[model samples]
Target chain A: MHGLVNRAIQSFVTDTYGPDRWRRVTEAAELGDFEFEAMLIYDDAVTEALLAAFCADLGRSRGEVLEDLGTYLVSHPSVEALRRLLRFGGDSYVDFLHSLDDLNDRARLAVPDLHLPALDLREEGAGRYTLACGPGMPGFGWVMMGILRAMADDYGALVLLEHHGPHADEGADDEADEVIAVTLIESAFAAGRAFDLGARAG
Target chain B: MIAEDTLAGILARLCPMHLLVDDSGVIRRVGPTLQKLRPETPMPGQRFLDLFDLTRPRKVGCFADLLTGEGKLGVAFRDAPHTALKGQIVPLPGGAVIDLSFGISLIDAVRDYALTSADFAATSLAIELLYLVEAKSAVMGEYGQLSRRLQTARISAEEQAFTDTLTGLKNRRAMDHVLTRKAASGMPYSVMHIDLDFFKQVNDSLGHAAGDHVLQQVARILVEETRQEDTVARVGGDEFVIVFDNLTDRPRLRRIAERLIDRLQQPMLFQGRPCAISASIGIAPSVEQPLVSPAGLLRLADLALYDAKHAGRSTLRFATPRPAEPAWTRPAAGKDGETAPPSAVSGRDS
Candidate 1:
């Protein structure tokens, strides 16, 4: 796993739960004095161990924790760069939803070595979409659902989202594609946050 | 064939910035999107050439020239914001239809006109271009942060490597590097080797803590007695070396050595017990021997220190100048003949 991902997780935990709680989690995982460097690479097992320990310490399910991570990423002040990057997708909520299909390619352009799961957005009808997350990290659909809910709010649109676990035909393996169903109820529920093409203030 | 009324509606929906001109070069109609660029509506009597300046296909003086241009044409509104547009012209029976889009000025156009996604065609790649620009900014931000972190880490690591943990002075490796540069720099200098006297007795009688405290005191005295241009280094457990820059005067070097020895002889109290220690210093001035390498000079100082230790432990000694080697004793090797093993030295007072 790329260290940026792990560092994000560390930042999410420390920023939300406090450094003391993060220390306990690392201790419980038997990681003696470990710190994630943003530019280095780590074994995949390190991520698994960290997640398992975090889940055990908080008594929360893995999917729930990961979903909250996705929400924190888009809405937190510490990660405002991420919000600005995604807001460039479109001007309207519906336009942003259609732009999800190209999310993987766009992410690759920023950090070439970072590998995100492939995103395929399919429209079922008016204001209804199904986003299929290709096989990669497990429980990634929950994370996408969290991002969708936050972005909809950012655009001042009322939206409903449901995370459908991987298909049962894939036998509960990590290889099965997960899905998130979205229904945008109202595009202009209220005035949205202002955005400008020129990111910096003159 | 399509009716003129229906054709206008289709063009309005497809290209909101389109314009329809009459055979006399008078503007008959303007698309809804282009109408938003100006305040006045119903511009039916305005001449096409009067409203816009032909920037590309520069010879277009009349309506006939619009039909003869081959590739994409460029035009700018002769008003505030001066929005530039690029498009193609399709000739009709009586006039020409001109459909245009903002070329590279999309950012300023979007900002100035307050345009939204609905104003553009659904198939336009403008959204993709916007995404690319934002992505580049975000990536560059993080790239700059990464560069700063890498630079800070490199400088910190280098400082740590050259510092001694015990006395906070430059270590042996740093001394070797600096001395090598100084020796090759074609400048007269001096090297002094200092050894702590009865330091081992402090640890033997008291504890290693007292020995450590005494060594730190010795380091402080050495630093206090030398100028800032001199390099003071802890080269061993109880040994230190200083390279004095551009100072080869023998009497001044001896005075510095005596002052350092007098200061180090003071008893320092560690845990309320006075730990007595002294220092023996030996100096080699480059004026005495001009052709020695840094390593050879250090060895000469070491030999003088040996003489001081034998002449009653706490005194200072100066290395005597060497006699010229006999021609028969010179090596036949080329270029490095002077780098031979230094002969024995007899320390003497200046």
Candidate 2:
């Protein structure tokens, strides 16, 4: 796993659950006193160990923790720069949803080595869309659900989101894709949070 | 087969900045967008030629000349803040119809007039262009951030490559580059070669860690005895080289070398155990024999270092001028003591 991904998880845990909790988790995972360096690469097993530790300590499933991590990434003040980059997708919630297909490509422009999950959004009918999250680590669909729910609120749109975990249908084990179905109830249900094209000087 | 009134309505919807004039060159009507540009200015009922000055079709002076104008027309308001527009003109039975758009000034016009996508014709690509501009800005902002991060990483990597991790001094590679540059510069300088006297014994008696602590202390002492313009490098485990820029005075060089030897002779404590060490120095002042290559200079200093070691450890020596042959072919120490002081190495250039 990229150290940036691990660092993000570390920051999410440390900021939301307190530094003492984070220290206990790292100790439980046997990570020693070293912190993840953003520019370095680490073993994928390190991330698995961290997730397992979080689940064991908090008594919560890995999916629930990852979903909350997704929400914190978009809504946390420390990661406001990420929110600004995402807001450039478009003016409306519908436009932002359509831009997901290009999100991986756009992210690669900044960090060429980062591997974000590939997304395919298919419009089934008016206001109804099915998003296919490519096979990767488990629970990424739940993360996308959390991000979509938060973004819908950011755009003041009422939306119904459902995450369908990896499943095999008709005795074929190849259907490993995690999917999320979105039903946009109202594009402009209320006045959205104000956004500016340029960052204002403090 | 379209009625005149319906044609007027269609023109209004298609080109909101269109203008129509009668046969006498009187303004019959102005498009809704053009009127919004300056709401205080009454445009209709005025002479069409008086309201706008045709910038394109250079010699156009009246409506008749404009009809003969072959290419695209360019016009601007005749009043303050003369907003320019580019369009085409079509001649009717009595007058002419002129349809204008903001051209390249669309962004500024949108900001100045508070115009929206609804104000433009449905077929226009203005909305798409606006989206592209927004996307370009966002990508450029992220690109700038990436550039800054890469620049910082490059500088830190370069620093690490040229620095000795143990002593925190310039390593052999960095010293080689500096020596080459200084030798090529035609300025007289001095090269001082230093070797710790008891560094090996310290490592054997105490440990490698204690030897490291002693070397780091020796590095600090050497740096303190040299000027900021001089470079002190750790060329080997117990060997260092100092290039004194433009200093050839033997008396001052001897004093600095003595001070370095005195400092290195001090005992350093590591893990509460005292470890003692000393240094031997050899100086090759270029003013004695000028224009030597960097490698040749180091050879001369090495010869002097050999002589100092023979004279007993923790001492200093100066390299005597070489024969006209070259410093590279000069004989090493222990060959003969014929060049000892008061006999042969006593000649001063000035």
Candidate 3:
């Protein structure tokens, strides 16, 4: 099962940029920070404005953009801008967040076989949640939900971290992280079709 | 008119019923009469522990799990009708299962059938040999799954062993591995040592649980501050060391430290109560001074950390590896935009 997951990840990487680029990325990861080539690109307000133009260019709704945290805008400028930041910001934290955001959008526009929908979040209490959802299309919705969760978790941790001391805002983030993790696991189950293994992946 | 005594002789050749299972515990088939007696739901997934209603599963095949199509998972039972049942299911290469008389009493049962004791034992032994051959093949079928489980367990154990049990964060063992690698890698890396300020007060005022929650919360923050490539380990009860690899720039490092301090300053809400938590961090820049060894790097980082503690909690201090070289600083906000440090590659290199 772990091998299956790894295969899925490898396939995703290969499909996105080809095997050569993936090999380079893995090499970079293994080499750590110093020996690797600088990969972050810079973008100030003007670049951000150019990137923002994509929102209107793509004819996206405010709800769509806001709800998805700017996942909808994927013009050449937006991707180029992100590529720049991903290369130079030197913040892998920010880069990962961008990668996940792109991944979310990538599934919608690029991956034709994928059939998953956005998730709904309901606040059960001050810090509780209820994902009022059913088993998705062969659990495709579930998989998307999980990927969303993993992105949030991995980046959220990277973004709001302290070197030492009493870590703050943990309670709020813990709720968020758990929701994300659960979504990922649910998606994994759905993707694996453990619920109904006999059915073909639609 | 015939009494039809020959009909009984022919009927006795075949057992009237049989119950069978695949080696993996899926209920494959039941004898014709019991087909409808079996539940409609699948018995493939249910583990042996949860399989049956009987207190313990006998090694023998008399037990059965009763589940329905509508229910989640369930169990049921039928009386074991003892017989020397034999059947063939060849598509499943392995020997077909016999639900009766494979137990220790098979020889005795055969003797009761009017066969001599030696004949019963000898013939039954051949059947047992066939079963053994089938059992060995089943074990082979399961080898891959077993190996994967063991590999997963080994990785999990390695991580657990290197973790601080209290906060579920990397511990000293992880630090040792990182420190060892830092010496070998020849890459410029920074060690930022951090110590919590006034943690004892929390333990004194609230309770150990409160202290623990604070530690857990901090673990969350430390993970956030470092790169996925970096190691964040709790080397002491209240001390942590972050190995920042791939030098971006000093300002970048400073920015991270500042962010860490600012985040920690905010009041922490733990277990329904708001508590104040603060820490002092010492930064040991790898490039500035040539480290004699990994131990020297640790000492320098420690010195920086101690300096921050002396400066007061919620503080950040940096130690340049070399005190003599002031030539290598990057112009963070330079006038001409000639970023002095090669570290500043003009933005967006991807």
Best by TM-score: 1
Per-residue C-alpha lDDT of model 1 across residues A130-164, encoded as one tens digit per residue: 99999777777877877888888789999989878
Better of 1 and 2 by lDDT: 1
Number of backbone-clashing residue pairs for each candidate, in the order shown: 0, 0, 20
Q: Estimate the overall C-alpha local distance difference test score of candidate 1.
A: 0.79
Q: What local distance difference test score does each model get? A: 0.79, 0.77, 0.46
- What is every candidate's C-alpha DockQ against the true complex, given to 2 decimals? 0.21, 0.03, 0.01
> Which of the two candidates, 1 or 2, achieves a greater TM-score against the reference?
1
The order by descending TM-score is: 1, 2, 3
Please identify model 1 stretches exceeding 4 Å from their true place.
Answer: A19-43, A90-94, A123-129, A166-172, A183-202, B39-44, B161-350
Model 2 CA lDDT for position B108: 69
- In model 1, the clashing pairs are none
> Distance from true position, residue A92, model 3, in Å?
80
Task: Give the winner by DockQ: 1 or 3.
Answer: 1
Question: Global CA lDDT of candidate 2, please?
Answer: 0.77
Please name the candidate that would achieve the greatest DockQ relative to the true structure.
Answer: 1
What TM-score against the true fold does each predicted structure earn?
Answer: 0.63, 0.51, 0.31
lDDT of 3 at A49: 32
Please report, as a residue range, the 10-residue window in candidate 3 chain B with the lowest summed lDDT. Answer: B66-75
